[model samples]
Target: MERKTNLIIAFLLLICFGLPRNLGAQKEDSIFYKSYTTTNMEPWKKTMEKMAEELEPGNYKQLFEVTLAWYGYIGYCLGNDKEREARQYLKSGWQFLEQLEEMPEAGAAPHALKSGFYGFEMALARYKAVIFGPKSLSALKEAAAIDSSNVHYLVEKGNQMYYTPSVFGGDKETALRHYEKAVKTMEAGGKYQQKHWFYLNTLVTLGHTFEAAGYLKQAREVYHKIQNLEPDFKWFNEEVWPDFVKKYGYE
Candidate 1:
């Protein structure tokens, strides 16, 4: 009878202590994904603040996740022309990237992030292009050398190809190829989990690239896939789909 009571206590203790950690791990990913889909930054901001409060030295995984969240937030700021906010986040993001760079456990992810940071810098200051443009490409190349097939590196490379000027070798066709490869690789690796905001964002980018390249049918197909996967995706259902419909007419 005593043994059974002890076993029950231990089981309850395990549930009480262990569940929060697992939930914490899932919470951040879910928060980021929700922010990405809904275009709402308030919840993401709270999560970032909480993560910062909980961060500690040598907590590489936490640091990496927070840094990526910051990256996404900064991108949102830039997209909305909130340069002031983007600049502030960019500074904080660079600090996190520097720490990650010193942690060998971080692998090539830091380099990919560095490439993104440089691109963000350029976006804020076009005059810095001559300097940061090469730096961005070089960092991405280094990231590729380390892990050529890294999903993050593939997405960054596609961004560079898609957004760079034609004079600087930007090619929509090349961009499409890179985006397609990234999407395929991610799908093959079973990376389309519910909390995988990066995979969804990559799909969104691919669809936009298709549209920009005048592949309306392909773009529509990709959008439909996104709709099926995330029916409540606010950015898509509210903004992107409406714009697409306005221009192309509903199918």
Candidate 2:
């Protein structure tokens, strides 16, 4: 019972981070992405291959492991097939989740993690709806039930709320709440795998959210903080400044 309880806690935690299907990524992937530059995904490809080689066969537990491995494979695929690869992994994620739910141990952390994994894929599916057809918001709703405080999925959900049309309940106020929750949770946790990106991404998202709400000074501060951290980061000098000028008419 104790072990089962622990598993439940862990699974819920994993789901919180895992189910956010946002294929959107962090500054670390940025390092890899910068290196690829339409020419060098081989490194990414090779890394996924190595990881896949070490994968264990699927079990009722740890199902998300397989899903995650496949996700790595799709994630490494370049350019034209990026979403295709991601979708393949998404399919794999759902298959694992099916098996996971059949057991009474659905309360386990692994099971919860599997939920997160599928939710993540679903979220990505929704975002890629332009290419992949219609989207589904069910993933976020389900994930929140599993673990309301899961920062990773919360962050993705937060972004969707901010960007999605009002017909979809994509309210800026709600999205900002999720984003703020994600930031606070990550900062407090401070030791997760995403610890490295959480701080930076949080600030960037905050800036973007505030900017959308027409808070220029706050947005500038966020960008300025990022610039202080990575003085040469291209997003600030290129994409962000141009957008600021075009939209806000900031000189």
Candidate 3:
């Protein structure tokens, strides 16, 4: 009778603490995303590797998601002067991505990640730009064709257009259009879904474009929207928003 009473108390405690059945899995995903959004690349990379290890070999959905996170983390590293570490991530990333490609359900997801990886590789060695650049472009095109409505693929295409040199056909206007399309698609998925890392990234990138173009009003609005979605987002709450207000004045 005492053992039964104790078991009941323990179950009540779990419920009272709000520990949902999937709390462990949710915690892992949340930590990795937080690391990414805060620009903590090294920790994000490590978290992603840890996640990859936790997932079973045949679990393609988790594999695809973790691999995508790892790809983004590597790109962040490459851009932030962490080339030595990024190189190691890139090598491991490629191996994981290659495995992801074999999953029939992965569709164009693997291609999109591969395109980003190639672009980063080109950034590291300009001499290889001639080879890797076109490959990246071609891979993105294939990914888009296969999954035209995919927000992730659209965001990547937007990134490529935004960053490519104007002489080489970069078009900010076109990039903005792709980004807007992605935003609309994500929005249609409902507000709750927008809190995901991918959706937040699309909105953040759009906000940056607005700020860079000197559209302060638009940028401010985007930042406010982000705050509404995630009030405690440290980077925005502590850094980007404060700096923007400092530069432009909070009217």
Candidate 4:
């Protein structure tokens, strides 16, 4: 009985002592991974979210509204199935912009707001077209009104022209004119400037225009530039641009 009792105690001690060592050894040289979420966000989207959180919507109603408009519009545009959401956001966005315009934000805010509002309006057109028919031209015109010097918007307008019938007002002449204006605006440092996305768009568009105008040098330059970019860049770049450049020689 004494011997059996001693053996039982020894077994209990081994069970408690042995397991953790084995477990610790298993994990001693083991590696774990830290990963980023797959979902991506734009700088503007992040900025908008951050700033919105910092502000008081109730106290600073108008300012808060402007932020909401920007956030909502951008969020809608970025959504996966964004058509309906975009429309809803635009309606809300426009309301905010209108209020702000009537009661202008009186300081450093206006500069960004001016540019951002125009950009929002441009996005609105793209969104509008997805749900309804062809209201993009009008919205583009309105955005141009806010900042006529934006070359990118003009090019976007020109791009939209591609979808419209020639009789309704879409013509290569108009496209060429918009493209030329965009080039001039960029060269002159106009209100509309090129970030990476805009720059890429410009390069590719110029390639297309040059292709049509028989300038393969410009075309190849754009294509190769696109090819050299990181694969995880943007929505269109990851998917559509690869085949697009390959098929047409980037022009």
Candidate 5:
């Protein structure tokens, strides 16, 4: 009887303590995705603060995931022209990346993140492009060379290809190919879970790329797919869909 009671206590203790380490990552991912879809940064800010307080030393994987979240959040701020807020986050965000770089487990993802950070810096000060532009491209290339199939690297490379001016070697066709390949890789790996923020983001980018390249039919299809997958995707349903409809008359 005593052995059975002790076993029950141990099982309950395991559930209380051990499970959170695994669940913590999922929880953060959920918060990040929700914030992204809803275009609300408040929850994201709270999660960042909480993670910063709770993260233990040498927990490289959690550090990496949190850093990626910071990268996304900083990008969101920059996209909205909140330069000051972006800069503030950039300060701590870079610290996190630097920590990842020093870890033995660090891989291509860190370089890819550096590429994104450089791009953000260039956006903040166009004059810095002369210095940061090549750095951004070089980091992305390094990341790709290290892990050619890395989804994050592929996405960043596609972004660069899509956004850079043609004079600087931007090719919409190349961008489309990269984005398509990234999406295919994710789908093939069964990584396109409905709650996966990055997968959804890649889809949205692909749709925008299609629209930019005048593939209105494909763009509409992609948007429709997103609608079916997540009808409450705030930015897509509220803003992207309306503008797309106004411009092209959705089928």
Candidate 6:
């Protein structure tokens, strides 16, 4: 009876002490997948904050995930009309990106993200465009040059072309080509072995590009491909597709 009682005490102590370490491990390793699978950024905000808190100060992998999460969080805030909150995330995201400067392969993503943030700032204030627009383009160019095959870099480049004015050398057809290259990069490299938000978002962007350029049939076909790829994506199924069909007169 005494032996049984001691074993029970030991087991309880292990549970008390071991769980935190286990949970920390999960937070560290699983954050990428967790962030990827969760489309809604509100809840992911808390999850990412917790993940960041659990990260060791100089762990580049965790830092990269946290930075990426901040990017998404900032976008979410901006989309929800929470500009103040978005600015806060943007500040942190910049700091995190700065921390990654030593590793160019990893730093390329941060540069790409910074480029997007600069674009966002320009959108918020027209005066910023004169200062930030060139900076945004430069950053993305650097990112792409650093890693020509990176899908993220290609996607950002495509985005820059898509949004720039025609007088500034923006061409929708060129943007479509960049996006296609990004998709091809992923496919050729098997980068989508795991469910990746970037890969999925790239596909969505392709569909949007088609729609924006008045390629109704191409856009509809892309949407069908998206449905086949991710039948469980609720927003795509219930909202984006339905609304897109109506807006584009796809019937």
Candidate 1, residues 101-220: lDDT per residue as tens digits? Answer: 899697777898899999999999999999999999999989988997887788889899999988989999888998999899888875356458888998999999999999999999
Model 5 misses residue 242 by how many Å? 1.1
Report, for all candidates in order, the number of backbone clashes.
0, 8, 0, 0, 0, 0
After superposition, which runs of candidate 5 have C-alpha atoms over 4 Å from their true positions? 190-192
Q: State in Å the error of residue 149, model 5.
A: 0.5
Q: Native-vs-model 4 lDDT?
A: 0.50
Put down candidate 3 lDDT per residue, 1-251, tens digits, no spaces.
Answer: 99999999999998877585257556656776677567565566667777877887688877876787777777677767889988887888888888888887878768878888898788788799889989989889889889977776778788888888899999877777788788988898742166567777778888877787677788888988998988777777777888888988886
Error of 6 at 209 (Å): 0.2
Task: State every prediction's TM-score relative to the real structure.
Answer: 0.93, 0.57, 0.82, 0.49, 0.95, 0.79
- Residues 1-251, candidate 4, lDDT per residue (tens digit)? 99999999999988898785445322321210000011233444444444445544343443543444364345446446665655665655655544554544333233334444444455556555444343444456555766655554666666655445688766665665677677666657632233333444455566566556555575566556555643444544554456555666544
lDDT of 2 at 85: 64
Off by over 4 Å in 2: 1-42, 57-135, 192-199, 245-251
Q: Could you tell me how far off, in angstroms, the CA of residue 23 lies in candidate 2 after the best superposition?
A: 25
* Candidate 3: segments with Cα more than 4 A from true spot: 1-25, 37-43, 190-192
In order, the Cα lDDT scores of the candidates are 0.88, 0.56, 0.78, 0.50, 0.88, 0.75
**Candidate 3: residue 118 Cα off by (Å):** 1.4
Q: Give the lDDT ranking, best first.
A: 1, 5, 3, 6, 2, 4
lDDT value for model 5? 0.88
Q: Residue 141 lDDT in model 6? A: 82
Model 4 segments more than 4 A misplaced: 1-39, 42-46, 53-80, 103-148, 190-217, 226-237, 249-251
Report the lDDT of model 4 for residue 139. 50
Model 2 per-residue lDDT at 104: 64
Question: Model 6: residues >4 Å from true position, as ranges?
Answer: 1-39, 104-107, 189-194, 249-251
Cα shift from native, residue 31, model 6 (Å): 7.4
